[model samples]
Target: MCALSSQVRPARSVPGARARPETAHATRALILATFAFTACFYAWSIIGPLSPTLQKHLQLSEFQTAAMVAVPVLLGSILRVPLGILADIYGGRRVFSALMAFSIVPVAALAVWHDALATVIALGLLLGVAGASFAVGVVFVNGWYPPERRGFALGVYGMGMGGTVLAALTAPRIAKPLGLQAPFIVAAGVLVVATVIFASMARDAAKPAPRTGRVSLVAPLAIFRTSARAWALTLFYFLSFGGFVAMFLYLPKLLVGVYGLSKIDAGSRAAGFALLAVLGRPVGGLLADRLDPKHVLRVSFIATGVLAVLLGFSYKHMVPLTAECLTLGVVLGLGTGAVFKLVAQWFPDQVGAVTGVVGAAGGLGGFFPPLVMAMVKSATGSYTIGFLLLAAVAAVALSVVSRVRGDAR
Candidate 1:
């Protein structure tokens, strides 16, 4: 583990002195990777806000509409592990560019094809690669920083998750004006640009020491078994990242359904929630560095449970409810950054693989909230049950953290 950890850590020149030129180079890499990865992730999540418009245009039922939007995320969850393996073997620079280029085809196809279900499912599969970009960015950025400084650098990269903020904000407005296909066309063009930039400028560590042989498929499973810390972090990440993605994809629908807001209005409010949460992400990481990560996480989950319950019950009072949701978003966002910092600390060697395993679980974690919402609404004709469940889950996560050792983070 120590040997593998060194391979991912950047080579340092001065023991105690700062070098300006090297700093500039690393800063530039960080900025570019953040933007590129952000655009890719943003494109991955564009379907949620646009679903209602597409449904209305095609005269589709609610169930059909939900499938179109949710299936891509489900696919994305499954793809992260293999994508992480690819990054481990080939390096992020090559794999990220190739995947982005490959994504262009399906995105373009969505632009040209008018068939609703077929287009959505096909494009959704293609876009799963974008979620894989998380592994790409992590491996890329981790190569630029030492283990001690890695949390902040990766925290900033994680902040690129703000891309979902951009998507939540703009997808509906853009789709409304230029029609459904325009967003895909623009997303594809942006991807092409990102691929070109990454190909030309991105750097990797000198070729990794030759592996003994291909690692077994059971490697990640074995790591999971040996490290109780990994499981705890996984649960925490499930609560934080899971809540973030779920809200990103479904908040617009929640707003429209419960609050009786128009699609445009609901989208804007959802965007506001995402934007606030994005700002909170880096703050969370920064806090982890100052306070104990376990403590930071404890507070985050507790606040999340409280806010989630408040928002869940707030449907009766729309004005105050919006404020409550914004608060929940911030708490969940901060929790996400802190949780990743914990991962970096515990599984330093398997950052990419661990990130993939934890991330895939997080994605699966994301899948449930929407389904729960649907089921509860279907059963009780209200979202109250779903929000209560979210609160309970968060509370359990908080309790679990209290039992975990403080040094793990």
Candidate 2:
């Protein structure tokens, strides 16, 4: 009990209290953490890019193919909660190193033993461990920055989303020449190198965060159930980050259906869409530092709602559709950065637990919209209703932002 109790830190009665990071290591910490996160994210989402190849090799049914892609997303998304909790208690350095070390096993397994549907699905569940790195990296980066600057630092860290872009670009190109297992081989090598670099260099923020309240593994769940602020933030991220992820995964299919573009062209554009969001994070963080995060949230939600509405009407038009999609990408990235800015501002002392809950919300949030879009498209033969539903959700979240704090916007 004593050893177990030592690993899990208690909660703070006061939120947003922590010493400044050791400046000497701050730059080094940010760089190494982002690098490690990039490799982890590559492992997390690489299956999406490799799915078609896997489907051909395994002769998988459509349902089976979809399941293989989705299992990792589901497991990786839900795992953020406990992983974040672990990062806080055990420290990001140990937790991150361990997570990647374990991830290498599944990556290596999939490279060689991926013939049967059951075997692939089981290994994919293990690979989801890589996606949990976000919560860990956030807590890790949060430890290194003061409350005011976390918006920017974490935003820079969020650039790790480029891992998806990298996977999209690299998986097919490399697999065409080298065979199906080659991409997994390369990803495993990257993780191995990243694990070594991170374990050697990363440090948590200065120790012993003020702990006036007792906490446990389930503390985040309790707060998630009880706290309206956490819920509000969760909803906002659900819309913003969730929307970003949904679009990342679904845009190619959307383009092919609506514009009748070739698969290669649609995929290239989807990669570009992801790039826009990747670039937007740091900008969003900078805006959060300069302006109030509330302002950032308001602009992001309002703009996102408006753009989504525009997209619904213009889905068949190539130019306007592209413009709206591109703008939506940047706005969503800003909302993601601003949400964490609020976390640092309001719940700094509980960064990891709170982040776990919020990050899990973001992850789970991505699941519904693609489902909605597909269902609405199937039933009505138009995606307008699905998008309008998304806009309605955004407006509701904007209202939550108005009431979440003391002021109305």
If scored against the real structure, what TM-score would every candidate get? 0.91, 0.88
Q: Model 2: per-residue lDDT, tens digit, 36-99?
A: 9999988887776666667678897544655677677677778888888878777788899999
| Candidate 1 ranges beyond 4 A from true positions | 1-22, 212-217, 406-409
Clash count of each predicted structure: 0, 0
Cα lDDT of model 1 by residue, 214-323, tens digit? 66655655677666777887788888888888877777877776667888888788888888778888788888867777888888899989887887777668787778
Candidate 1 structure lDDT: 0.75
Say what the RMSD of model 1 is.
4.6
Question: How does model 2 score by TM-score?
Answer: 0.88
